[model samples]
Target: MTGEDIYFAGVGDVHGEMYEMLGLLKKWESRLSFVLQVGDFEPHRHEADLQTMDAPGKYRKLGSFAHFYNGSAVFPYPVWFIGGNHEPYGFLDRIANNTEIATNCYYLGRVGTVELAGLKIVGLSGIYKEHLFEKRPPIEEIDRHSNADYIGFTENEVLQGLEFQRADILLLHEWPRGLMTPDNRLDVIDPEMVGNEYARMLVDSLKPRLVLCGHMHRYFCHQIVWPDDTITRVCCLAHTRSGSNAVEIFRLSGNRSIESLRSLDER
Candidate 1:
């Protein structure tokens, strides 16, 4: 925990739109310390992996990260991400534990934490599914097309989240169930947009100062009051799309105080 303010930007569901984020980062480069992309990261390591995952023929063979991985272009600042259901699990499985892909870009494992600048960030990479909790497809079996494409945690992975004592922030791929406050403008408050139970359990146990997620593809903010009476702010960011409010920035003062939260790109 440091006294100085920690500045960072967060975006969600890039869905292979890395350049769009890079452009937004450029607009706010002077003020940002780092950027976090919540999910739908789509890191297709090799063209063949796309086919191995049984992706549609029409789906692009290359991922946005390919350019960064090949050193053709570099992100201006460090970018960290977790995986969503649409990602290439075969590639992610190899470097699932805080692997750095580009000069300053990283994948924050299925269940782990990484310290960036002065903030401690925990990541829970997949979404939640009740049936998959007890048993999930092995990375190899995930290639089958008939099975549901919803990425999720095995019981062991959910248990891993319980090991963390605390964190400055929690970057999750999906919103936690029953945490949102109703706002007519935001769909995340609706029951249909509610996220998974495993995530809620982790939030209940870890109680991080802040939680960020985006699988619902909408912007929302809610205050989470834990059983102990502590409160955590959860922000559900929008997906990356043209003219979307998908990029948000925040300043963490001291260890847990949020000094500011605002859009990174004015548009």
Candidate 2:
């Protein structure tokens, strides 16, 4: 879309809180160009689909996704999301990557890219698992393995992500390694286990202007300044259950530079 400025929203893990998530964005719906969600969306169509997810039973209840999928409820704006550790593989695997699963809700797939509002948005779905790093079975064969098999991004996906020379925004489900330092370490998590190296590699390679991630269910912001003095801002969002800190708003100028960035949770 051509415009002097484009406004949009970025959200962290929904974890099946679809109605609540949508409610929070309602105030900005008319002004937003679109919405980006950083995985763990859990768009289960029904109880059967919810059963196929890899999350613990306690966290496995089907949320409001079916309402949107069935057209009983409509999304206020276009929504794009990736796959996280807790997702309905049974339903999502049936659909091709980068395809719209619902009216205005899209699945960004394991590795996918799209241009929206004069911005190139690239996404990598799923978390990093050492054993699953080297292999990515075809979607058709996904049913042959456990849900865990499709929960980690593979090397092939990373290679696909590298194909993009640059991106305006990079969407990931997990944080990139090296974000945690003495200045930003959280008391609850071990510094060494904060993020994954593969994600860090993508950030280093692609050098997107903005990197968005969620999975740790915490709010964090960091800037990685390249040798050339280019800065890549990384924002990790908390779960939607946590309220305002889970969402942020951004406005990009016509020249494709970020004009403003703010958290919806900000007072």
Candidate 3:
């Protein structure tokens, strides 16, 4: 790691595609850094509001709702995740709102920080209320496992409270702006404009050198249009090509400059 503070590895939209994580882990796991999965762990079930019983007269609570490597492989570093619309609210939302569950692995609600390789990592689940429009469908209406639309934080709410400038990296579930695609499939019609509006807001204002996100599924990368002098690089990474076999390794250090920064953006 250069004078650059730390290194970050990220992935998004695993739609139950656990196999894709191995290739990346195989190559980069030995480095001194951290790993982050933005959201969409798949195989998730929302049992919170689904009091309705299944065939056997037993009510089905959310199942297949936890975040995993999917491939069931162990990552070399501490693996952390943000909330996706697919996570179990009975598990995640409760943890975010309840102070007691703050540190529990099962529920790493909204924003939490991890320090490694001399970097501070801050994270937020994808299913925040602001990302879900009010006129948009209810949480249960859109996805099966989540109880309500992300009724928790707005983009400003998240930005105002957090100490972004101090953190080395930020992990989120959706894109900020110019990053979202106009033709997302889940809408079934008009675009929902989720992260397109503000993921950019934090990146431009906070100026963290790196931001890792999911939700768009396609590959993406961008530099912060406006940034602080100390935080010179900005990147929006692309998702792995396929869940079974895809990976990207990113390197950073204080010595980082224009030459190597461009190299990281290559396909």
Candidate 4:
């Protein structure tokens, strides 16, 4: 654990499948120092009343992560994640700003940077919504409805993100725009389903060593060369709830910089 190399695991959307996710991680636990999920971690338990609320099916509250949140189950390794469109905002907001949900599990807020296992990790929860980003709305306004909160972010949150300069890894629920195929004629992702433009702008500015994201439910990887001649590895993982071998590993040098990237194919 005190060497020039550190090993960690990264995954895509959990969508409240904690047990299923943990089952897969079990094999890698001995080698991995920690685990990180991209989004849709669903860190709350639904009350009886909320479960019966008159909201639409999608708006209905579900507490899949409640077991972990309430100490019914414990994550064997250090677990970290951001919020997604499907999480319980009420519960997450209560413990905002990297609060520990369990002994080894923590929530990375709307926008934040943390040092873990000698690596700098930055996280931003939720995808970029046009109404919130351009209108500069407040979280208070979005809090009026349960679904609105899932859209995520206030003007302040975006502004706070601008302050983050560099990180060893950046985690977000959305993908950066303009990621293309090897031929570069068209986008590797859906044009209409592109992610945060501001996030892409930050990638240009911060130039982190690694950027991991979810929400697309598919896997893609690209090597981005920044203006400073530094390289950033961007990867989108498959939904861990269904995707086989959901965990991806990365190695870091003693200087706290990434040395190599590993994916399911490599295993």
Against the true structure, whose lDDT is highest?
Answer: 2
Q: Write the per-residue lDDT of candidate 3 for residues 158-247, one digit (tens) a residue.
A: 664255555556667766655434443334343345465555556655556677776666555554444234542434444555542223
Clashing pairs in 4: none
Candidate 2 lDDT over residue span 1-267, tens digit each: 355778888999998789989877777789888999999999988899876788777888889898998999988889999989999877786778778888999998888999988789999999999889998566567668777877899998999999987888999999999887787788755787788999999999999999999999999998899999999999899999898789888888777677435733332
Q: Give candidate 3 misplaced runs (Cα > 4 Å).
A: 1-7, 42-73, 96-108, 127-148, 155-165, 179-194, 225-234, 237-246, 254-267
Going through the candidates in the order shown, the clash numbers are 0, 0, 15, 0
Task: Sort by lDDT, best first.
Answer: 2, 1, 4, 3
Model 3 TM-score relative to the real fold: 0.62
Q: What C-alpha lDDT, on a 0 to 100 scale, does residue 83 get in candidate 3? A: 61
Candidate 4 has its poorest 10 consecutive residues by lDDT at 46-55
Worst 10 residues of 2 by lDDT: 258-267
Choose 2 or 3, whichever is better by TM-score.
2
lDDT of each: 0.75, 0.87, 0.49, 0.72
Instruction: Please give, for residues 3-36, the per-residue lDDT of candidate 4 as tens digits.
Output: 6577888889887778878877776777778887
Judging by TM-score, tell me the better candidate of 2 and 4: 2
> What's model 4's lDDT at 5?
73
